[model samples]
Target: MIPPAALAIHLSIGQVYAFSVFNLPLSQIIGVTVSAPADWKLTTIGWIFSIAIVFLGLSAAVFGKWLERVGPRKAMFVAALCFSGGFFVSALGVHLHQIWIVYLGYGVLGGIGLGIGYISPVSTLIKWFPDRPGMATGMAIMGFGGGAMIGSPLAVALLDYFSSPISVGVSETFLVMGAIYFSLLMFGVVTVRIPPEGWKPENFVPSSKPGKLITSNHVDADTALKTPQFWLLWVILCVNVTAGIGVLGQASPMIQEMFEGVITAEAAAGFVGLLSLFNLIGRFFWSSLSDKIGRKTVYAIYFGLGLLMYALIPSLGRLDTAILFVIGFGIIMSMYGGGFATIPAYLRDLFGTYQVGAIHGRLLTAWSTAGILGPVLVNYIREIQINAGVDKAEAYTVTMYIMAGLLLIGLVCNYLVKEVDAKHQLFKEKKREGL
Candidate 1:
């Protein structure tokens, strides 16, 4: 039941991933059928996504401690308000044809919803299933990965129902989506509950011996910032995210250009869909596996194998093997998603669950950093190579090599992670002293 509640929130907020569906329609809002002089440029519209991501990171880092203070119910309720309110505000902006209003609505207000909603259920799930933290977190986070699957189709359908001779129906679509998401999020708000103090599952005996990497002690989020392990994990997450996110943004274009005439736009879209499916499955599969194998080993596989997959994509393009190319990237995308799903449990293992949600929130700044870094690296480098006389098919070759280099750095970071120092366990002592 709690998992479903978490899913309701995650699946709704995950719609952020499918937001590209609105790009063309948004660009054509004034033109109705095509671009009009008054309509926004794609570049301008692109900033909406960037702003939302930036705010998501910022708000999460800022509000994480507050969420810990209030509990998931209140945090989720606020998330519902902000997220749904974002849609309502964006709808107004769309009707009025004001881009800045849309940015304020979806980018700022909605992103706050995203940040709070994203971390809301994570710590609760980790607490409820202490014996299997990775699997529990994976179950909920997997919904986030699969969210675009539901969101993209739903938005398109709504747009079709609402479109007309004069209207692209983006405003109408936003209104409907807002209502729907609010209802779904309220389910999470109503059902989410923290385990009673000192509660543990029946038959679950506490392990007297903690692993070297697994801490029985706690670290507050503020103090966790001062530890080396936190920064190391930050580097690991940023690099892994950077490697995958760059390719995700450019997946369709990259495949089309790599294969040229052999791959149709339709086939390229199918490729993107396939990658999304892999992303969804990998979120659950790898994280659940981590409960048995350990988080560090799973991340090691992500970076180690990721480096090989990225390095090979260029050659697959040169060899003109579309199937192998898709396979290679499918594997890469899975690891990308797996990296996200597994990290919360990794944090729990290192920092303990005392403020794991807040700590998790702080770590998402790495995602914010990667969101900007990944696209810039891929998009800018490709532009540079093209301007320097590189062929369309080969432009990504250099980019892939650079992505592989990032994975190498991530691998080193993952290997470097040992355990949090006991001195940082001062928070545990404070708890005993009733501080």
Candidate 2:
């Protein structure tokens, strides 16, 4: 029931990933079929998504402790309002042809919803399934990955239904989607529950001896910042995300450019959908696997295998093998999604469940950094290559190598992670004081 509740919120907020579907329509809002001289540039429109991501990180960090204190239900209620209201506001912006209104609505207000909704279920899910935190968090976060799968097609269908000679249908689409998402989120708010005091799964006992990296001691969110382990995990997440997000943003374009007429735009869209499917699957698969194999070991595989795949992508393009290229990227995207799902449990392991959600929220600032860094690295490097006389097909070659280098840095950071120092443990101090 809780998983379903979490899914309802995640699947709706996860629509952010499918926002590119709106880029073309929104760009042509005034022209209906093409860009008008007064219409927004694609580059300018790109900032909408960037602003939303930035705010997602900011709000998550800002509101995380509040969520922990107030509990997920109230937090989720607020998320539903902000998220749904953002859509309504953005719809008005579309209707009035006001870009700043759209930014204020979706980018700032809706992004607040995204952040709160994202972390709302994390601590609750962790508490509910203490014995298998990895699998529990994975189940809910997987919905976030799957949301784009549903959101993309749903938006396209709405646009087709509402499009007219005088309208691109974007404003109507925003209104409709807002209503739908709000209904979905309300279900989550009603269904989600926190565990009873001192609750544990039936017959599940605490481990007499925790694993070397697993802690029975708890660390508060503020103290987590002073620990090396937290920063290491932050680097690991940032690097992994930076490598994948850039490519995801460019997936449709990259496939077309790499295959050069061999793959049509329609085919490229299917490829993106396929990557989304893999992303959804990987979130569940890798994170659940982390339960058995240990979080640190699983992340090592992500960075290592990801490095190999990134290095191989350019070669696949050069070989003119679209299938192989798809396979490589599919695997990489899966690891990318897996990285997101696994990190919460990794935090639980190192910091204990005490304020883990808040810690996780603070950690997500890394994601905001990577969101800007990754796209810039990929887009700018590709442009530089092309301007320097490099062919379109090979323009991504240097970028791929650079991504592999980033993964290497991630691997080192993951290796540096160790048990949190004793001085940082809140429980240890309480015990020492005989509390």
Candidate 3:
């Protein structure tokens, strides 16, 4: 039941990842009958998603401790309101043809909902399933990936249903989606519960040694930031995300250009949807694998294997092999999702469960940074290449290599990861708190 509630919240917030479905439609929205001189450029519309992500990181960092204090129930309800309201506000922006209004609504306000909703269920889930923290966090975060699976297709279908010469159907689709998400999220708010203090699963026994890496200490969120371990993990996450998100943001166009007539626009959308499925599955598969191997080892696989796959992408594109291309990119997407799902448990191993949620919140600033860095790097480079008379098929070649380099850097950071220092450990602090 708890997992389901967490899933409900995450599934809705995950819709943000599918924002690209609107990129083409929104760009051409100003003129229903023909091209509008005032139409928004794709690059201009791209910032809306970036702004929301930036805010997602900001709100999570600023309000993470507040979420810990208030508990998931209250935090979740507020998230529901803000997230749903963003849709309505964005609809109005679409109707009026004002991009700034859309930015304010979806980017700033919707982003706040994303931050709160994302972390809301995480801490509670960890507390409920202490024996399998990796598996527990994986389940909730998997919904985020899965949400994109559902959202991308749903958005495409809705646009088809309501589209006409006079309108692209964005306004109506936003209204409908807003209402539907609010109802589903309210179900989560109603169903979620906190575990009683000292609660643990029945028949669960504490690990005898729990290893030197897994501590019996409790670090506050503030104190966690002062430690080097946190910053190392921050670098690890930032680079990992940068390697994947740019590929994801531009997946639709990249595929179309690479394969040209071999893959249609609709087929490209399905391809995006397929990647979501891989992303969703990888969150569960790799995170569960982490339980058998150590989290550090699992991340080592993500960075190392990820580096090779990224380097191979340019060659695969050059060969124009659709089947092999899909398989390769699919594996990369899995590791990308795996990186997100595994990190919370990795944090638990190093920092202990105390303030893990708040710590996780602060750590998400890496995501905000990557959110801007990834797309801008990919898109900007591709644009420069295109303007310089490079073929669209070859434009992404340099971008893929750059992404591979980012993953190599991540491998170094992961290799450097070690247990928190004793001075930073909070065993004494836990005793003071009477725990």
What order do candidates take by lDDT, descending?
A: 1, 2, 3
lDDT of 1 by residue, 1-435 (tens): 888999889999999999999999999999999999999999999988888889889888999989988999999999999999999999999999999999999999999999999999999999999989999999899988988999999999999999999999999999999999999999999999999755688999978986679988888898999999999999999999998999999999999998999999999999999999999889999999999989999999999999999988888997656999998999999999999999999999999988899999999999999999999999999999999999999999999999999999999999999999888875656765744
> Which candidate has the highest TM-score of all?
1
lDDT of 3 by residue, 311-363 (tens): 99988886756888899999999999999999998988898776788999999
Q: After superposition, how far is residue 63 of candidate 3 from its true place, in Å?
A: 0.7
Candidate lDDT values, in order:
0.93, 0.92, 0.89
Error of 2 at 57 (Å): 0.3
Query: What does candidate 2's lDDT look like per residue over 48-140, in tens digits?
Result: 898889999999999999998899999999999999889999999989999999999999999999999999999999999989999999989
On the 0 to 100 scale, the lDDT of residue 145 in model 3 is 92
Candidates' RMSD to native: 1.2, 2.0, 2.4
lDDT of 3 at 46: 91
Model 3: lDDT of residue 322: 85
Global Cα lDDT for candidate 1: 0.93
- Candidate maximizing lDDT: 1
Sort by TM-score, best first: what order?
A: 1, 2, 3
